[model samples]
Target chain A: LVDALTDRELTRISCGSAFREHFGAPYTVVHRRDLHGALLEACRKREEITLHTSKELASFGETAGRVLARFADGSEYEGAAMIGADGLRSRVREIIIGDGTPRPIGHVSYRGVVPLDQVKDRSHFDDMVIWIGPNLHFVQYRLRGGTVMNNVATVASERFERGERRDYGGPDELDEVFSHTTPHVREMLGYVGKDKNWVLHDREPRSGWTRGNVTLLGDAAHPTVQYLAQGACMAIEDAVVLSGKLKEAGGEINAALLAYEKERYLRTARVTITSRIFGDIIHCRGGARDLRNHLLAQRTPETFWEVDWLYRGIKA
Target chain B: LVDALTDRELTRISCGSAFREHFGAPYTVVHRRDLHGALLEACRKREEITLHTSKELASFGETAGRVLARFADGSEYEGAAMIGADGLRSRVREIIIGDGTPRPIGHVSYRGVVPLDQVKDRSHFDDMVIWIGPNLHFVQYRLRGGTVMNNVATVASERFERGERRDYGGPDELDEVFSHTTPHVREMLGYVGKDKNWVLHDREPRSGWTRGNVTLLGDAAHPTVQYLAQGACMAIEDAVVLSGKLKEAGGEINAALLAYEKERYLRTARVTITSRIFGDIIHCRGGARDLRNHLLAQRTPETFWEVDWLYRGIKA
Candidate 1:
């Protein structure tokens, strides 16, 4: 990716919703020292680095917290401070402040990899398909160099709760979401014929995610629902903003941490609200699907203009 | 108003949504001689002339259509070939288009009026009060010389079908919409109480409002959903743009009329769609109401940002 970017001589970087996934020589993908080495190397060249990982918090500490890591090592890490980029269930999250908890928002999610090679029709390579109804959505996007399609489906359900299934499932549940999709989208997904399922968990905005010198970051500090496609972008911003405040602290890590936490609360709260509001497009069901679609048809891919600033970063 | 403007030497007219009600006054407000004298006087004296009216559609088609207008000698005009600035749903609309019907969107609206003296809080006047919940909305403002408080209530009711109830309503239904309102807003409404109800009708976009020397103007040509509060603003814009195009046509009224029609379609369609999207705030029923309020609370008044150009009028 750096080589491709360097080939173009681009300086500043702000990520869009998707990035191309590349597969090459094993060493080219990750040179033995593993993902951390690759991440650090990217930063070394002034290339903005972003990583998307999902995890949960089992338990908390004042300055540092434990994280449920899903890297190849399967080992947990504890440090003086943690960037809770591990998402909603960040172990760092549970440690920073004990007041927050993920509440069951009564929705289920479905995702799948639809192979583009089998699709035969390549007309949709640069296009996205969003099937929205009152309370449900089925989205399909080209992935894996546009060779494979990534699909995510969501529905508003009354049954699911926090203590239930930890491992979200596959295929059949997603078929139900697609049952009523438009013929064009349904036909495209039909070409792939299978999918995966998961539950969507969301928590309300929190006041603080740090205690003393230790701090929480990204999804650890503030978790957002998926409606805005801002999850990864927000975490990346957390890292950038944290670095900025830390640079200004003059070794007063605690002060820097305070600044970071305070600066972020309002913005994260907004994304939290925006994501949930956008969830309407996903969790819409039955007749809601039609209303949502009609509304979508009316929208110009810029309906949620208020949240644009978040994804665009701090405007330099 | 024209004389006041002339005496003041005003160069521009920019009426925000709050300043929108007095565009083209009904016969009850301005005598015809006074009105024409004012217009002719302005035409001869002023560099520019502008008007703002929110509900003038009550006179949709006075120019191209016949109207039962009684003169001082008890005479009437039919298929009137004069200017139709009467606004949307003009009696002229019925005559020109032969009483075309308004489609029903299955929505009912209630408006409340409060005297400024009755309001205990004035701080909110800087921003409009929008208490929106599932399937209903309570909109309040300090309008008309800032002496009176204006409140508009909107809701989507399955019970209110097209052509079923066109009569203005009273307080019972208004109270029903507020049954789920937050206590704070309910108390506010109780303070102002009811003034009257409005029959919020629906209509699809029309292809053309002119064919010959006569042309439809304002609401007579296009009507809007009040969600974006651009209904009157659009009419005023239409009046201005149509006038501009007419003058530019240089005696080719037919060409100018066609040009105005073509120019207004896309902008109005955008406004139409945006209005409905915004109407989503009031049309939501049940859980959607809570969702809408949550969304609105999270929204910045910068919601105005989305329609800046529309309110400002289309660019060349």
Candidate 2:
């Protein structure tokens, strides 16, 4: 989606894992000395994605109804408006809404990415399969052109007491969630390493999805856990809806942005709530699981078959 | 699998809704008659699958193999071999592998069969999915041509010494296994009615898979908690291997039966042990779940993927 509606090219960055895993190749195998040049070239080609790097707004300036985002480098671009996809620690989110502290979700998610063929019995599973057991749940899905499969496992916890960020989410925490999963699942997780990732499940909807011509999308506007497999789906939806409103609203940046949030907030909020509802249903009380099973036995295929056409034909 | 081998054409007893669920609809509706008649007709089809229901063998009629069965109609069919697939309480198993009564593996399972549609979010799960959480574990699977899903939830219990059918399985006894499951799971019991199947996890491999022509199969031969979704799989595998061995010996029933037991005993024993390993992984100390997850992360897809394949591909 980023490839559309912009003249700016993209640059990708990582320790080669994401490159091989997500896009199946790295931007280049050049030395660190050439990284800046590589990034600039990537920006030219509109193909840059970064992790393990620092990003900050070098300058936030306003033009005729346009917000300018100047990075640390000399790169600057003109746009009708800037969209912030920055996440939970979103600087724009903090600057615009003034809510600096992130609320604890009382949940933690452990995530990994493995190749698709690595799994056993693909005949019964799907491109995206979820195992929602009692207090914890996990999702496995294909990505990177189906060359790799990603896994995200979460566990419900009432304990979100503050602790050192570095110390809190480590191997011990990831292990805790798997303890309740099956041995089959335990065997599945045998490959996660420090090279993997874990994230806390605590973020609120941004108070304002937009400021002037600048707006937020994806995790910045409405952060959510992967419970529903709707994170990327929402971001894509946001892009489409925003572009539609922007093109239709014409010259009024203010009206367009308001309309975008109005058109999107309640809908996204509903999804956010629904996602959480689904999570609770999967991880709720013991009897709830029973009722869920009974209802599934009684209701699933009928309900499940319709999902493909639901959400107004949104395809993931 | 059950339908392909059944005498469905002769017997047609639809289970109102009781015991039919755990077996699913395919096993229920696919089989033309009630379990009682189906068993009888099944026995007639190859005259091979005998209906031992209500048949009690009084003495061991020695034919190289001592028979442990007695017919209800006062008939005897002693052969060179015998088996005890009578379930958790097997007279054959008892006589052949004499020892103290079976001991619970510090766990007991809650079993229920409910209308498939009754389970809410049923589509969100698979016909077979295992949920593992600290101190709690449950498995859900669809049966009867995707009509109903059977559920078996397990939890550790030091004792069930209460005056609730210490020797007989009953609904009240079944309810306790679900005490810690989700509430939705508990509500499904509305369909549980008078017939409930909760059994202690008195699972141990048979010390002897054969006592001459008398060989055991299914739960009687080796009772297993549904930790790995391999119980029914093993039974089916048993039939295949036993039949193969019998065929290989050119209908020399004695040699074939012995080989069948020999081949199956080791395989079944290994599966049972792995499931117990899984049980320990899921239902052990709170700290253990964490350790299990950590161990999984350290493993690569190559490491666990082949192991899963080996498990699924194991024959006989």
Candidate 3:
């Protein structure tokens, strides 16, 4: 995957070099926006798909066994079923589920990419380095074909509760949070510009996604924190599995949607929960941190391949 | 309350006459549709309200500190806040909360009114009698100023699950369920026609409702089982308390909504849970049914008035 994503100068790092065969695919780097744009373009090329821009949902209901979606301008569209892929603050999810809000996990993340020219040294360009500590972690990865390095710093926020928004406090505050770290880590923080931080929100696993003729997909169905970087991947998987289920069900749209839900629910839930646990392990304090590091050092090729369950698809 | 509602011939009943002073307000009967229409007219008269029909939610979002509602026709309406009172399959509830379908408790109810003249005798014309048996219960009440008697028969169904529509099996199935019940009860069940049966669906208590600038009200927020008869009453109380809180919040819409939810959550949840318990107690079988009957027979006027928790409201 690393060779496929970018064949730029590779970083020989402590983690990847230590367990190259076990890792199966070397960690690849890609810009988030570029990946999103590529997916959008692929979707646009599909013959059956017509992408509508700036179209919003007024309300939705069922009439004569068809899903009737009414827009604000008094126009309506009818279909056998409707798939809600409306991201985290999903309106279609709201229509089917009623009201449940995403919970804040008291963590805020600052993300930005620094141009390679600005860095004093670029020797770590191929290394995806994760600096773990008490209630905080910093990850630096190559992006833009290794010309720029992406830096993400996650810290435990003090004031924000489960439902409250985080108040961003500029780059100086970012510097203060990582003051106890090594000098090189402190210098990495200097590269992050203001206006790049955001509060991370997620939800517990839910049993429901399909209701009658309406169903949910992607973040509208299950949204998780960015700890695993599998949010977009899971959504893409949902689209594929859902389409396959719809075709498999013959002509019953609701039944097909339900089948899709049954197939994808546990897999997505596992990803959501595993990502949380993975973050907790990396952001440990005191004795737990030593234990986590010890476990990482002890990773055999066989044990590391345990993540094959994640990289590979679930059993039929 | 009875005199205020209508000037019809009233039933002098055992329960009401037995504890006249303790009951507080005399029970009044009004057609559900008539009462709903009255409420609608009152809402229509309010100058602050504008009634829009056929407007459905296409999608919704938050922008510039406002809740943006987009209809299916591609038009948008922005508000400082939104209150979702869309009832049962509420579109607004779906937007604020994701998908959690209501659970069915395996019961179907057949309801209809029989004119007093249809019966050979009208001796129990004003009396409200509940005949309970194993897995079934029959309720007979006077309606339309004692000119008619309404019979409701609730029976357990084997075929349907929660979120599935109830199949109306006509009077023969109703007769089969109540064959072992009392002769009078069996005769009363004959009065209900084939078309009035409905499946009862409800949800367990949920935690999330208010999110940012949007919230839910009444059935859209907390939909309870009909066993309590408090569904409409609780919805009415929600409206009153929500408006009061909104006024009290001064200018903070989210705070007012949070306050309204806080005041109502526990009270409504209690009603929802208690109603389910009451239904279970009423629909007991074998030894449980005998025990329940014995307890009902032993009830004194004081014991009957013990429903002050329900009638007078829970202690503060």
Candidate 4:
């Protein structure tokens, strides 16, 4: 990581070493589409699992022994149990929890990918670099076997601060926010896609993930902001734990779902809250920003004490 | 520091090394009365200073060149400038800023000092220990050259949570809050004074400390909660910097005050906000608490990087 204004190196850690030391695996970064395709291929090979597409869930209802899911096309499916693995804005969560829309957290992100040879600057190309500044940060990393460079620039939306939600995070706002950054960071902003932007939103974590034979999973269960880059990892962890609980339940679906919810609730909620706090720390202005820079600059790159609980995964 | 429930050691640092290495002085703990007396004696020795007693400030006003202060006893004094070193409830601040009372952040503390031999248990007497638990913490340290022990117990008030502020933090609440803590921590709670308790308050940091010939200082400028134990320290820092600015400005009082305010505003504001954040960290519950404990346990006691910006004092 580097300070976007002064270009001072804050701290650096070897992701490979951090993962290898804790989990006995090298830290690997892959594109989301590639990972999704791989998972889909693996599931297609399974004999009992069937994949369905173009079926938008409208709502779900559960009885003591079974679940019924209704789709937007006036079709219905009955199953022994239902798992809502839908992403954010899951109809399952809306029906069960009754909370409205996810809260827009006032941050706007522009992201894009380009071939490595097309990039003019190579200073931070070999490593994942985050240039942090007041109310703004730029992240850069290599993807697709190091052939493509992905760039993301996120800034606190002035429009959102002024209480205007729609038509915010535009290309003009992106340029205006990055205009004051260092020359290197400013030049890199050219790589970010201006046509589209992500307005980040997250739900305040709640506990009732399981009701009867129906349960929520992944982003539907606990949608979090992307500050920690752990939202997808958390969903994967949820799947592992939930599958283990199901296998151990001896055909009792409700008991297994409750046990899974009990184990996963606190861990995911901490991630959701901690991610928001991390955003505040990185995007803080004035005195708080100065304090953050001073403290972060003093940290040793090799020390992993602060992140041990996170990277070590859940305790058995 | 230790976890109150399981009696697990978190992390420790030598105060002597921390202060000596950073500030070229030993970390010294003294009673508030003794410190106040020493400051009063030093002021008394100065020929330019006069001490007054039993005088309550009613209001103050200032012209471009002069400041006039009025006391509730029907007396008025005029001077070239005014400094509101009048602490948390300064009338000078009331006249200048008109911001109302400080905000009570939902915590209550009871503190008292007793002779060293009054307590039966002495396992943690030699060290300044803080037993951190969910929404509550107990602190103990030796004072007055180790002849007496100062005990402070702080807990998040249920009454405050229920929106009934008055008559809260009573002795009964104290007993009920510490009931679930370990026996050692519970026993130490007996030493806390039951007659009165302090409801913690701190202001959201603001920047307008100076207005013309009059300015606020100390707690009046940036009152803070006691979580970081830096309230008095920030005040002393303000005094030092203000004096330096005045001496540098020669006869320009307004210029000196403005410069002093500029220099001290960000530093003191950081302290005020950081203290509140520290309160949340120590009082965190459930998953966040678990994460804190796990991370804290992995830290080597001698690593002072996190506090280098704080304990090292301000830059020249």
Candidate 5:
């Protein structure tokens, strides 16, 4: 994987123990847009997968051994099994499991990329640095081959009302939430885009996802909170396992769907739940915050292998 | 009310300041089944109310300005508007809101009613005693006017598997969970019914509960965990408020339903979330547990009046 990237795109080397100790494995930092472009190009080359753009799902139903999907343009498509890989606000999911909406878990994040030279203090530009504090965290890392630095600052905002998604939160609120953090963290906050705040939302992991000839994948199935940074990784893993299960089932759609759900539900649920609990532990106040910092400060590369199961590819 | 009951059914009076100082309102101590029977009798006297038994709901739908409910026995009933007052496994709720099931919140309780004479200690029989401890709580109160002592002991069970409702927990497990409690609390636990234990389950407070001519009430709408003891109170309040809204709406079912939801959602949500948070606070461990106990012990009768809103009933 390291050999596939140019030297500039390779993960920058640094003496940041927080980065080196936590992720003992090789890491590369690429902008998510670039990663998506590469994967989309790879999909475009596959003759079996046809891409559809602007085809909004209106509703879906199953009948007479086929899954029928209707689009907003009044066109219909039939397939043996339909996979709902649509992101959050999924119409396929709404048709499958009616009416329940994703809930806001009272947190928001402001993210943007800045040219390295544009930043006044580029001290941590070569390293992934995460400053954890009470009810807030600031993460900065190099992206797009170190030419651009990506920053995500999240706060547990009481002002982020439940059931409402706001696209842009005021910069004053951002400053207030991060005012207590170190000067370096406050510096990273300056690079956040003017109107790019995302109010984070997630659904409680459902007990079941597959029903008959229709199933869900990726964010549609498990819209995990972004604390773990495993949302994309889990989705890619799901694609592999789901395809493998379908192939192994030999055209038995129901069996394949059941097998896929069984294989992935536990692992995905663990990841989602662990990530949420990790956020809770790191976002504690008073004594608990002290305990969390004391524990994190003691992390060493050998002892930080708890995430080996996550980094290592899924077992066959 | 006291004069209406026979001597054996009258509430036992004692010099306990806790009971007199806290409630400051009319109270009763009747077995739930008996109280339910009395309410049913009262409803039977009303010419407009009709009671249906053993009628399991199959499905329901609304059409032609009426809500049509189908029963498993092929019988059907249609009404201008329908209120789903069905309990936890409500079929009406399933028809209205699909696919989501109640989740177990990793707790279980053993409850039983023993004759007061059967117990060796009768020290606090006249008073409702609640013992809050780390990851466990014990509540005991008199019922049936002191003839029976109702004991409910709940434990935060690590052994309790998710999504599995165990009917009978082993005595050894029960003993292990309550082993750290005082001797008096342990004595109360000894009277737990041998073959009866309840697995507590609750859903996240849903944002909306009404659609068109149909709505939900009580546990069907918000199946709250029993920590707050407001489940029944909320349901009764729902009945009063829902009926008032319908009357005020002047035959407009949709408007009435929406009004009922608007009037009740915030209040019920506050109750449910507060109860869950109260449980979390009381169930803390180590330093947190000590803090909770300290706060609880220092609570005066006036201080406990924080729930005046709950007891005083919903405002018009």
Candidate 6:
């Protein structure tokens, strides 16, 4: 991590070795397409599994021994159980919890992918680099086995803060927000895609994800902001825990779902809450930013105490 | 409010007239003893009300028709329903919700009340004055019709931050913490009691404060840190709502308790959550504090837009 304004290098940890020592595996980052393809290949090997697409869920209900799901295309399916892995705007979650829409946290992110050969400074691009300034941060990392570079630039939107959500966080605003940063950071921002941006939203953590024979999984259960870079990681962890609970339940669907939710409630909530706090720490302005930088700079790179609770996976 | 380190006037809010115009009554500060006495006198005028002292609760349970509360002294009382107005360490809540002790947020406060004649700077004492610095704040205001001044000094304890809970916020540490502040803030700190200090704690807001014929109220339901100065105010609001619900229940205790909890859940939870966020905002350091001061200083004295949602009392 680097302070963008001062060009000062903040603390860096050897995450690969640290994660290997802690969890017997190195911390890994993968492209979404590759991960999704691998998981789909594994599912295709199973005789009982089938795949469907473009089937947006409309509603779901449970009877005495089975669950029924209705889709927007006017189709219905009955199954012994249901798992709502349908992400942030899940209709199943709305039917179960009904907490309304996720909250917009006044941040917008722009991302792009470029070939590694297009990079100007390969030395700085060798490892993951983050440039953090007041209310904005730019991230660079290699993906697809170092063949491509992933770039993400995020900023707290001034227009969003002023209560105009639409047309905010555009390419113009992105350039304006990062104009005060180092010229190197500004140059890097040029690689980011200007055609599209993502508005970040997160839901407050709540407990009741499982009801009857139906339950939620992954982002459907706990959607978090991208600050901690743990949204996909949490979803993967949820899959592992849910699978383990299913095996332990011996075909008892409701019990397995309930156990999964019970095990995941506090952990995922911690990630969601901590990610917001971490965002504030990094995007802080004025005196708080100085204190954050000062405190973070004094830490030893190899000291992984702060992340022990997070990186140390829960016992399934 | 003043920045103690820079001695800069950050913002001045005319809360007196603002609250008066908004609520038809001015925002009033009173000594705890006087407030308690007035409440006790009012309760004494009611024939059906009885006050008990030093009777610590051990546990409570509900039967088909009655709720039974057992005291630590082995005495038991049976009533139609039990309202756990018991405060922060509430045993009633322990039995009902079972969430553990309140979380310590690493803040310590010392308070003292002195006669008006003891104060050297009466001009600053006339209005509620708050001096904020990085990681610490000192507050002063006249109480009991200006016969006395209530002084409070609070700091984010270094020892507490370093994981030493005990012997952390003593007078010596207090002095060391405020040594960098302006002379006036330091002198005001001299009036704060040295012997006893308070460590702050609050709980994450959760639903389900009511079950059966039993329910929670006040800090027992949703304890908050003092940053917003709304702990007592929220508790009072709970009482009003609870009483109204009981009268509307028309002899149905379970209905009444559930109704009260439903009404107070979101509001009180909001206060608890916002208080923590507000604490972070006020106790900010580095660039965040600078931004806070700059933004707040731009506000008009009579602009109460930020507090409209809070100070606007709910309709019963």
Question: Considering every candidate listed, which one attains the maximal TM-score?
Answer: 4
Per-prediction DockQ comes to 0.05, 0.02, 0.01, 0.19, 0.01, 0.02
Docking class of 6: incorrect
Number of the top-ranking candidate, with DockQ as the measure:
4
Model 5 stretches astray by more than 4 angstroms? A1-152, A155-316, B1-24, B27-29, B161-170
Question: What is the per-residue lDDT of model 1 for residues A55-103, given as tens digits with 9 covering 90 to 100?
Answer: 3344434433232333443535444454555567766666556655686
lDDT of each: 0.55, 0.56, 0.69, 0.84, 0.71, 0.84
In the range A191-263, model 5's lDDT, one tens digit per residue, is: 7874767777777665467889888899888787887788888888998999899899897988998899878
**How far is B56's C-alpha from truth in model 5 (Å)?**
1.2
Which 10-residue span in candidate 4 chain A carries the lowest summed lDDT? A18-27
Per-residue lDDT of model 1, residues B135-201, tens digit only:
5666666655566777666656635533345442336655676676655566666654355555565
Error at B305, model 2, angstroms: 45
Clashing pairs in 5: none
Score chain A of each prediction against the true chain A by TM-score and list the results: 0.67, 0.70, 0.85, 0.96, 0.86, 0.96
The DockQ of predicted model 4 stands at 0.19
Please, what is the TM-score per model? 0.48, 0.40, 0.46, 0.68, 0.51, 0.54
Weakest 10 consecutive residues, lDDT, candidate 1 chain A? A1-10
lDDT tens digits, residues A1-316, model 6? Answer: 8898988998787776655876666777899999999999999999999888899898888898699999989999999889898899988899999999998889899999999888786657667888888889999999999899999999888787767868788888888889999878888888898888898998877779999988998889989998878988888899899899989999788999899998887778778777888887777675356556656777886778777878887775
Instruction: Assess candidate 5 and give its TM-score to the true structure.
Output: 0.51
Candidate 3 residues B14-83, lDDT tens each? 4565455666566566667768889889989999888787888877788765998888877788888888
Off by over 4 Å in 3: A1-27, A160-173, B1-316
What tier of docking accuracy does candidate 1 attain? incorrect
